[model samples]
Target: MNLKQEMSHSPQTVILHQHPLTVHTCHTVVVGSGAASLNAADTLHRMGQTDIALVTDGMNRGTSRNTGSDKQTYYKQSTSFTDADSPLKMARTLFNGGAMHGDIALVEAALSLKSFYNLVGIGVPFPHDTYGQYVGYQTDHDENSRASSVGPLTSRYMTEKLEAQVRRNGTSLFDRHLVIGIITTPGENGDPAATGLLTINMEAIDDTGYGLTLFNCRNIIYGTGGPASIYHRSVFPKSQAGATGIALEAGAKAHNLTEWQYGIASTKFRWNLSGTYQQVIPRYVSTNANGGDETEFLEDFFQEPTPLLDAIFLKGYQWPFDSRKLLENGSSLVDLLIYIETQVKGRRVFMDFRRNPRCADEQGTLNFDLLGETARQYLTNSQALLPTPIERLKKMNPLAIDLYRTHGIDLEQEYLEIDVCAQHQNGGLAGNHWWESNVKHFFPVGEASGTLGIYRPGGSALNATQVGSYRAAEYICHRYTQPPTTTDTFLAQAEHLVQHRLKLLKNLVVNPEQPSNVLAFQQELQRLMSRSGAFIRSRPALAETLHRFQDELARFPNQIHICHLKELPAVFRVYDMLIAQIACLSAMVAYDERQGDSRGSYLIDHEEGTHRISHQGMHFAFSLDRDFRDQVCETFVKLDPPADSPDTKQTTDAAVAAAKVTHQWVKVRPIPEYTTWFENVWADFRDQKIFDEKRG
Candidate 1:
């Protein structure tokens, strides 16, 4: 359909076309329709708010499957007699995963058992034992029986249930809609409160052209998923498109943007290529042309003490060097070395299912006992996959069956592949504990908010989405005393912004360039990041890459071409590229300034006796742009030991002594203080005229 025709036929599409010109009466508008957004809408309804509308790209297939299965398993495991885990314990485990940087109150709320029960009440079908006890299973990063899954498709299932609930409550949904920007008003404290949203109805508009729409809402919730798409081969759907970029462009202060996780699944051969098929391989075993080996690269490199290893094993089946312990004990250096070695060896690593007996059994249970039953019914009734039972998948993959049959590997296997995935980006629109962002009336939840702190434990994602949604809705219901009118000034500003974006889009369409010009530069950028920024970072490489990036930014305009008037697609893609650069640069700075040995994902040297060696030290170094120039800074910290205990000093001393390290804090001439250094850096960057040049 033509853009105008499509917009005229659909209510949501029409809203977008008229947004710039129409003065919308403000109501509560949720920007995503995931679990978080649905929960938020539900909360608003419960709190007696009727004028609520949810805007989302569409019902996300991957997320819905994951949530549905996760919810089912969570309920089953929580009520199982074999599982005696408590919410308090779950909360503590989550806090440790985040290195104690996460908010305690938020963690506690997320772990509440009632949250799972609430999901069951909302039409989530959970697994149950013969006695009606809920069945549960273990998953990544979760210490207790917190995860319950029908299959890998739990997310999709949960999303469907939640969507149904939202629909039943009469909460309006704008499907296939993309938010372009946010409207905010200056509040009493100089904070910009979100007043409404500008969106494009992608489904309604023709593929060739689409117009902008305005959505006036009292509160906005951002459950826009993660920025993994910024990387070429993320597990998430490409449809995600990093819409959060638009929010960031609209003046959102995103934190932890630098903390994106690097999982082991990335294909080493095709590291820099987009659309390359990548597998989420287990990390327990390393395979060469010879065969599978049982050596744990991570554990061996860290030279993890038996005590720590024992503690990790006891916690659950999957604990890959507790980041909390590494941070406290100053032994992250060792961890980094191992990861670097594994990557350099050119061998694909798989989680050694042989060591962990529970791995196969768990897979079987998920496949047969849970999803198997459903598949059987479907196949019998509909002749799907032309198979009577899908359980035959176990035999199709020899590695899986061999581990199960020959080795007697059971579902509760002791070891599994545990690698970091770009799970979530916690930094997006700055918000308070109540979910209100810097924008007075705007709120963010899920991966779109930075309130979750640096690291999130498994299952916490579900918790945060549900809790944040409910909390934000509750706050808005009480704080929004009256409906907001579309004032003349607001309409004028919206019109101007819309016109500016339209003009930019038009310019791009009329001036198309060869694809190779843009593709070559993109490939070069990806190659630079893969070698210098992936897995490990060093001083010289970082400095060199930043210099290269500066040059690229200068030439980007000349090298790239745009052939569309809808700037949203091109703008979003560019933003992703920029964010990727920012993430890499941040990692480089952190690695460069950090003097101690590398730990976790960051490694110092590839092999033993190399020029680089992971050092053990009390302080970690990081660099940030303050005034615009990069400045290195250090913060004294301990990772393994709890920060609050009296024995912290003794623990730090012992850890340092074990590593045979000593340091003398000497004051160099004219040492810059933190504030002054930041100011100077910020000023330098601003004066460099880079931002202006890029904008132009």
Candidate 2:
């Protein structure tokens, strides 16, 4: 884990342990050692840009390397050549996800097949049918079975493969260097141009981590994962420290941050309870604090428990929490049922796989014969009409229970504690066709880039990361090229900025507080964000949360004091989490004011018409050739009056700071100059085969 001191990595990494190195520069620097970063470095090398290097907090620590489940998702166009599957169709469907850009969707679809094959080329073992065609299954928000996977550790497998490729290419890897700031200069067009990054060696060998460096580069590829820790309750591995907040602080415009994905996952083992796991019909139980009166909490929310339990069965496929489902009283209602049991009733809820629910019809036993048609048919077809959920799981994916067993949770005997947890952020640094953020020379790959829409197909993010990484490298090589120069002017400006940041960091140590309880503050931030901004949002609650965060931000100067060099990353992570939360709150404020309707994972309990408003539809010809230019439609966000409203916290700073949250471009996007855009930006990056070699 001490990647800095362990300078013995061959073929790739160059570590500086005892040396007081001040500055190192490269043509491009990929920050974060996830799959995206490895892929980006490799792509740049392929583009004949071998002067690329990667800096990361640590090796073997990232969302991509550490997180997995029963079957991780990999979304791409089926190479099996289905009758209805095409790049254009896939692009249309992906773009149709509200708040996403069409052009980006097209880019994802067009590059998907190549992106997928590229992974296979790098040694990722994706399952294929006997015909040699990749096998896939249907996932959330997709009518087609376009998702493929190689069990739970698909992403981890991908990171391993990519890291090998990166090593083979001998891309310089500087591990344990945490990037704390970016150096921006005035571009030719006067927009912010990111020229360098300010970083600190976290492992400073018993010092205060004073060893800092400014990585000046022609381009900066941000591959850090999403801010999963923004919520107190999250499905991400604790090591994932996303760079979205770093982007925000660097003045990059963020988009659709209010749009996120949340659903049920085991609290102990962080595995999503979807697919066959939900279809097996486990008993949903809630126990009181004293652990006595066990209750099937879903029965109270639904008129009859049968429909609710049936919905739970479908929760396997319908994983992402959707507001539309709740309005239609659909399967997503199961998410709401669980959310209420935990968030409202203040109890612990679990999915017991030992046995099926005690039937209301047969008094004490679940009659499998009387199960819902869908559940019955599925079990019948699988030949898994067993007495217990574990038996059905064994018939289905036995890895479901085995995965938890490895994590110290026996799903068969012990109850699987469940809750509505934050999974992924759909919106990110508002990126363009090439995954370039609004800031010039700064590109985002993986979850740091906002290429997804409100409702995306399950397992699509992995493909997005791959596609974005390749495209960003191509774009940097072609369109946004910068000369390698640490000229006096640029170096002077960068050095000034880095010194400022270092001074600020030093100030924290010089004026120490009562050795601040960093973990307690982090937990408080997560608790507030999950309660106020996760699955459901109330204007009053968000306003209150904003002011509360403002108060917390104001207290930063006095309360934040680092005692050890090892603690620097944790403190900065908490700081980034706050910045990310503020950005999310800002976006939700726009949603509440401009498009005041419940959409995607953003559920605002508005008193009917309390904040009703409309705006011109956001349109873009982002899809290649503007194929989806006509797909624009007026979208709305609405919530019927809640039965009973929660008490609103009153704060003077709430309304003021909430209104003042900076949004560079909330309701706009890059208008691609088609005639020039393709020739100017997409000429080299476009996949000719996707357009039948027509050079689209």
Candidate 3:
């Protein structure tokens, strides 16, 4: 097959339901425009696989472009001359984060520098000293100083640079194209493998058949990010409605679906309150819903100011809410207290940078000398022992203050409303060392892939995204470089699915009296997930929650009625979220049945209530499970045919009930203990046998 000629082939148009739908045949379809997706296209092009197209919901949207902290971290192998770091040592650090596969960890570590330098070569501007060594700092869960950054918008720079490279490489771009489904057919082992994608072009949504389009590809790099659209309280950009659900419905398994990272963030302008924002020690205050009658809330819980001050300072690097920190007056108590004030008490919480945290004994005065050793030393080192939080922030990181200003916020004078919100998912679609899923030819990279486990170093996600894309692209070039299935063969397999979807689409528009309730349904889904499936879970409440979600799932499409053709994208998005939510809730219920305890970032509420924390006048109790960090929770969805309904032809209620989701607990794969003997390893490298190992 001539790769260059394959890249030049234009899409063929197929008439289905009297609509001319465009079908582009390619070797690979990279589904997303984020850093990982763009890097996949560019890397595949560089590796000589030119027949690829980049499809995305939006060009300038995604967490990678819109989200960050005061100084967003990028975890990599230490580059400082004084630090002792190697691929093996770094792999151990990542592998020690419970439930992560050893082979993936090793691959990520082994290729960390190669990925980092690739970004550098593309002009990402990672900081380096005069000696040409990239200096680093310590981030959460990291023992060594392996973190680096380019200010708060590190990922933004990365996306911009990689996007430029991808455009320069002349890879095809499908902007504003939402992937509604993954087309699959039986492959090598007679199991379903990714064959193509079914998409809707938003630009032509008002046209006939709602602008349906298709991609006939041999492989797919799924990088649509985490299932952020599932939660109401999320830091993910509004545009990032992840398409992981469609893949799950296509027979992909999920790993560690219950693990997530939640942190206190400014609710008004969604951004993480990590690094300098917390280190400055701002006052935690709450007010009535109308934003009056302000009271210093944290003062009521702490007898003295030092412990409270120290906790707030630790929130800088401590960042994500860890259940372990909730015990013994640790940093996570701040998140719990805030959760109680805002969620339980029905009040609004904010961080007032203008004033110091108040205490009964302190009398509204902050004494730098009374702070704990950690806080005192850190502040002293940064020369930030200033009077107020804003002043300290201005001195420590002016960029933090400016970032908010760009978003119509004046942090210097106004209060930053904050709440404990979902920041990132540690779990997502399950994949192997090369980022390939259980279904052959489908690769989930970046946050879309559940590679990271319970506790990852702060910026390791950025690194993993790059490394996973490289591995996926490399694996494809080496062993899977074959021409895509003929268009006729693809149409033969996809015709029925396309016709079914078109029937649903026509029904949505033709029934004008039903009205489009997409927004309302989305809000309802978000509320359900945030209440039951965020960082805090109640075992008894989850069973009922799962039942409610299942019922909703059963009533989908019938329950959803859109009046216009333009609302098709939103209708499909809600459908995707519904599928994803059911599987996630199922995973949560399974974990609860296994007596999974309060560990990592979430707490499990149980009647046993072995652990207790008191906030305001209310006492909350939770059960603790024995350590199961060494185990991985994997989930798979089995699709059953829709049951027959006598009243209506579209019995989606039966279809919802047909999705039988199941989960299992298995021991986590250990890091490979392989021989490093040079000559022996060289033989395997020569034979290209290293990539074939299935140690994980």
Candidate 4:
């Protein structure tokens, strides 16, 4: 299905604070252009809600469009004819991952096949067997073979297909608009309800005052993704800077903010070095900053070649860095070694695929017989037990090699630089089964929603995004079908907030005397977060970083200086990043203070911890918080003045000092046990009582 380029619509213009502002009014405003947001708009339009718009900072920029692995998997129900599966069983599998809400899991599991078929119907070429069965394979944290993929660019294809459908539907596409704030009004129950959005048009920044724009709509489907730019070492694409902070400031509670996935990823091309990349057992080499003094570092710790080679092969299956795998010289040891070499010793690490890993006792000979049972049998079955890693990779999956060439990285000629980089956040803004936040009318779908728990199946994120987007759109079209309030009413509700933002924009626009500090601020914040928040966490470091980030956020526009109007978007990105950092750091601090031990994808460095791993005079002591895994941590913050708490006075102290920041740990919700009686369910479905918030 080929389609022409989509253009942005001309919105009605209005003057605010002496600057011409564009006003776009729609029934539903989807605040991103990723696969999830596009699916939501497409589904909404198909369901008879024609007044839809998609607003994005960039139409072609996001993790879904730019990032993937060796074989990007999409998890769904078992589709093969011989496999036995049901929605209830899949729900139990998802719920078994501690701290996940059972109802959301059930919804995702029940809708998994529907969502998968939707992509299939839109021409995503998910491969199937000659017998007309969609074959599947097992992924991490999975008991069933429920994962499938279409090569290294599965997500890219999904995004393109969904986007073509949305463009053909004539949905309004507002590209290059940065969402700075979410406008809310008082609900009937006295809680804040989102009514609109405040955005900055990137193209008009030079001629207008910050390119200020307003989106007054009845509903907002926020799919802007997770906070990827907060980390200095991340596998997320360079363009994926998330707007989660603004949503948190708009009274959306965040869940499980501390749980994140980290893995060894190639730094040069920013791709996950999983699947066949590790299965071939590439040599782990380190060198000085100038690309000299090359050394194979893994041999320094391992006395033999068999165990080390097996660990490298297992790294393909166990890709994510799991703390539990550290005790037995497991695959996670590979990550720790890489971390020490790059971060502590200040050396560059690379994977030499051209040569197989060699040990002192091996005498430069490849030994296939010494491999472990799992690695040996897998390689033997795939006919990949060749002479070198490159030969094995080429024989097994040539598409993996081709993927690198497309990005200008020739694996056959050069080595690939790698780092233990942050990959995915298992948590984000809180939402119910319908993906609606506690703040009424606000929905956070895709990676922006805190749907996944501490641990999840590898490709479950893709499934969750489809299910959540469809569910949110269904709810919007049926239950929340009312049009937005009048433009005058929207302005009345959002005037003070708009005026305050304009004042800040005016101050930033006039500050040319000071040199531009956007890059400095961004680098500093990313470094602070990567140091204190990524994979390794310490109580003192988290607390101190929280204080520092809070101070930085409070001093936002005052300390930030921009020379040209074009720098406004970058300046605002720093502002949003700072807020996100403060919230994430605050959550880390609270988790540490609550006696939360290391669990999931991170390790809490404690001297008297229960577990310890040592190699070459480097010792790591971490406590496994097995009990903490059963509970979910929730965070709610107010960096700006709260509308509900009008009597609370603002102060000059850091945002944390003047704001209300709260964190609480609660028991996870158990899986719902529903009656399977047919007649009773049919009556409820006929009456439309299932859509009621109370029942959900």
Candidate 5:
């Protein structure tokens, strides 16, 4: 069958209510086909909306492998002393870890333990005990029964299961179709109502690459995933190419764009041990000059003295020093470290584990065992890391084992050599608890929406996707009143956008210098972000970084030419750089205003007393609009400060009296002026042409 004929005969077309070219229509159009998107589609179909289509840039080998192995294990679950360890406690931890930037309502929604269990019930195969209690495990920073893994492949497994469900629901899957932009029209309150989508059918050979196809719908969900691919090293698949950039280009305002997380480690290779090749692991922690562990810095700031000591305190054990008081200094310590590392060192300082000889051997053993077990399981069951067969991996990726033998690094090692790598961006399309962006009828979910704020807890990505998607569906299904069909203005606007995008795509293909510019800009942006914005924060570095970013913006359009339409990879790179710039500016401003010691990742240094301390009552500033102008601002509330006991207050009062110091207590100002910090970030982004070009 011909391409058009095949599409017409496809099951997806059979379920559609109108022809593909229809002007005014209502059909379900999912912008992504990832786990979240699939869930949205299933839910909509269950709600009786069968006129749907799932669009994506064809599945890659990574999609199935993305979910790690299904080996389930159990461990003791503990809570941080600050958290009561209840569901509410988990929610609070997520907020604090996120710098109190996530939506409280969404957090509350995600606290439902049943949500995780539901996935399990739907064939997720979560690890469980004989009595059926869910298995839990401990990770790097989590405190609480927060994580349960069905091996490393939990994400991939869940996605496949969701995809299966989507198919069963009769929802059309448009593989290899990319959503270029959202089709929006102004609503009653000047909000842009997302009525449909503008897409490119990449499958057709005759596809001019300029033909803009519109998929009309009352609601649009962006499950386009995170922007981690912009970084040099990332765990995400290459297919996750930051489609949110296109969304942002289409008038979506992303919040928390200035809080990109860095420091991640991915498996580099595997080794052979016990007649089996193991996955060789690399060292993956950030460190300082003295080689006194950087984690020690966090410990000192938190006043725990050590990780085990902190664990002990969390168990209600008391120590000689007040750990709570010590943690208050964490923020300052982080800032000081950043200043020293970036401004003084001139070279990237990392917690290098390559110096540890044990890294290679330990990692190798672990990799061999893991692969052997996985291979065994795959042979037993027809499934082996999704579509890739175990036999094929053994034949095709022999270097995975060869690299380990040649290098000392093995995957079994507990401590791997690690360095700070650029992580997830905290900012994306700005949204409320409902997942509704500034643009009406448009919903941003997962990493695409900066709803979770500065830092997300270990498993919060799953939580965010589930809750955000559910809430977005709820909002559109409940709150919206379908607009009249006679409104040709909405469809007309979509048509115009389609044409404009086509022209841009054409220019991209025809332009000669775009590819080189893209590569150059990408390198420049990565260097700038790494040098000034990576782990630590300081004013001088931040200012210089901003200047560099601005320079890039000035040189980008003129120097780069986008000739090959397929070479639009630079668009995402440019988008990520701009996003990173915003995040760095915001973080820098916050660090400048913050007076205390280091807490968590937001660190600054002070001369005396304990170096590490956690700051209480810190809040991040967010805007509903993407322009980040001063006009639209809101401060989300965070955890309350530690309360003083009656005895402590009385003792303080008595000490004051004993000193015989007659003093007037002046009203203290709220520290870390959020508004000023926000303005700095906004102005930095606004001053750049990148923002303007995107806005236009």
Candidate 6:
């Protein structure tokens, strides 16, 4: 068989699962095929609506099916009758994270109970005890033990269950179709309302590249997942190219574009190395570029002044990489050390759970008894104090090994290569409490909708997806019978958009310069993002990167030429990522430079230093350049209304499509109250007790 036939027959391909597209009109058009999209469509069907079609670039090409850690978590109402945890309380805790989320946290909390039940009805098997209690655990940043799981495939299970319901309900499915942009009509409320979608045919490879398909509908439900793949080292599934840029292009406000979550993950499969993976105390092994010189490196960095076991043990609760961990020679120092080892010292690092980490002396050797008092006490109490790291992992979560085994990494016998990687985005197509964007009828669901504040517990996103999707679905169902205000002018405007996009794609396909290959461009963008855009952000680098990207934006479609029809999508995805990075980096720099301190995942290193290092042929690069090191930091942040403030004017549909609307750095307000933080992390550890009640 030819390559096309071979790819078409692959399970990942959309051809085998292709559903006929006959009707162009529907009440709602749901973009994406992830759990969030399918759930939204399923909810629509249950609400007795039949005219809805779910579109995706390809079937099962999302984080829901492709990403997992030792275990995936889902949050909801407190299942323990002895504990008092209300949705309002959940909302308050969410609000405490930061103002980036606004009031959507409240909405998410209020609806999570019903959302959890909806998932149960759809067949997600969350663990429940014999007493009819849903036993829960404490995840990162959560003060309460509200999270539950069904092993590492919780999201995969959700996606499967949701997909099955979607199929059973006979919701229209359009596989291999990518929604390039959103179509909106001006509503009676003076806001732009979604009326249709602009899509690309991924199956048809022709001279003009992707075939365009425009679907007119009253509501547009966007659930394309997060911008996780925008960075060089990311835990996102390979195919998750989000539509946040298009949503922004269509005049949807993006919230908390600055806030993001970063952690260590395996580079090969892009799976997170968190929770039990850290609790198992894996050996931090490094190899030199020539591939011969090897060393267990963590001990060399943590010298005698810092407690090695304490730092390693802390990695369990503090899963996300934080700069503050560098203070007093803390655990986060492990991330900085690994970053330097890999990116600067020309070495590769791996997490070897096959053996417990080795130490400088006999007493320093990692053991269950050597762990910080809290970790040691808990393991001893739970009867999980195993000798080997893999054994400990099996005791804590056996599925962690099975997950890796399924991915060809036998945790019992092999090392899981890892690096500090981009895990999640706390920002996306900005939407409201009900998941509605600035544009009226456009609803951004799941991670695609930036409803989260600065920081959230590990599994809160799954809840956010369920809560946000269901809320958007509820709002959409209520408006099911309401007629869309589509007009001759709206159609004319929509046609203009199609012509504009076609013209752009034509220019992309028939380019003479071929200035840069999609891979090279993608690499450059990812490198730039990983450096100045992520974790250890630099103001000068961010400014320079933005200036560079703005130039490329001007030359877009002309700069990157597509030689093949299949390459067309990459060009657009790269474009989307570039634009998204521009917005993300800009917000990150703006917010970090002002805050001037570390909080949650938003950390900016203000240290003054310079060094010359080599890594994989790249020349010397500083985390903070001389210009920025000497520059003054903003002591106080000037307050302004939120990005979706009522005062902001709605851009015209023509203006939105014409690229007339720019991503302006709006004035940010002061920090709100009800913030959650711990002066002593160990206190939180003692109080929350890693979501276990051993002490109790």
Q: Score residue 630 of candidate 2 by CA lDDT.
A: 24
- CA lDDT of each prediction against the hidden true structure: 0.47, 0.72, 0.85, 0.85, 0.46, 0.69
* Model 5 per-residue lDDT tens digits across residues 558-672: 3346555555534534644453354335445444443322333333333333433223332212111122111112212111222344565433222210001011111211112
The TM-score leader among the candidates is 3
Write down the TM-score of every candidate.
Answer: 0.62, 0.85, 0.96, 0.95, 0.62, 0.83
Rank candidates by lDDT, best first.
3, 4, 2, 6, 1, 5
Which has the better TM-score: candidate 3, or candidate 6?
Answer: 3
Worst 10 residues of 1 by lDDT: 271-280
List the pairs of residues colliding in candidate 3: 554-653
- Model 1 agreement with the true structure over 599-657: per-residue lDDT tens digits: 33333332321232333332233322121112211111111211243555433222210
For candidate 6, what is the TM-score? 0.83
Model 5 residue runs over 4 Å out of place are 1-26, 61-89, 96-111, 135-143, 204-211, 233-236, 267-417, 481-488, 506-517, 547-557, 569-696
Candidate 4: list runs displaced more than 4 Å.
Answer: 1-10, 360-365, 509-515, 640-659
lDDT of 3 by residue, 2-117 (tens): 21233545878888767788898889989887789989999999999888988899989888999999999999999898889998899999989888888888889999999999
Query: What is the lDDT, from 0 to 100, of the residue 370 in candidate 1?
Result: 23
Position 337, candidate 6: lDDT: 70
- Residue lDDT tens for model 4, 45-119: 899988878899998998899999999999999988777998988998888877898889999999999999999
Cα lDDT tens digits for candidate 6, 586-641: 66666554543454553454443233333335332233212221121111111111
Error of 6 at 430 (Å): 1.9
- Candidate 2: where is the Cα deviation over 4 Å? 1-21, 205-209, 360-366, 480-482, 509-515, 609-660, 664-696
What value of lDDT does candidate 3 attain over all alpha carbons? 0.85
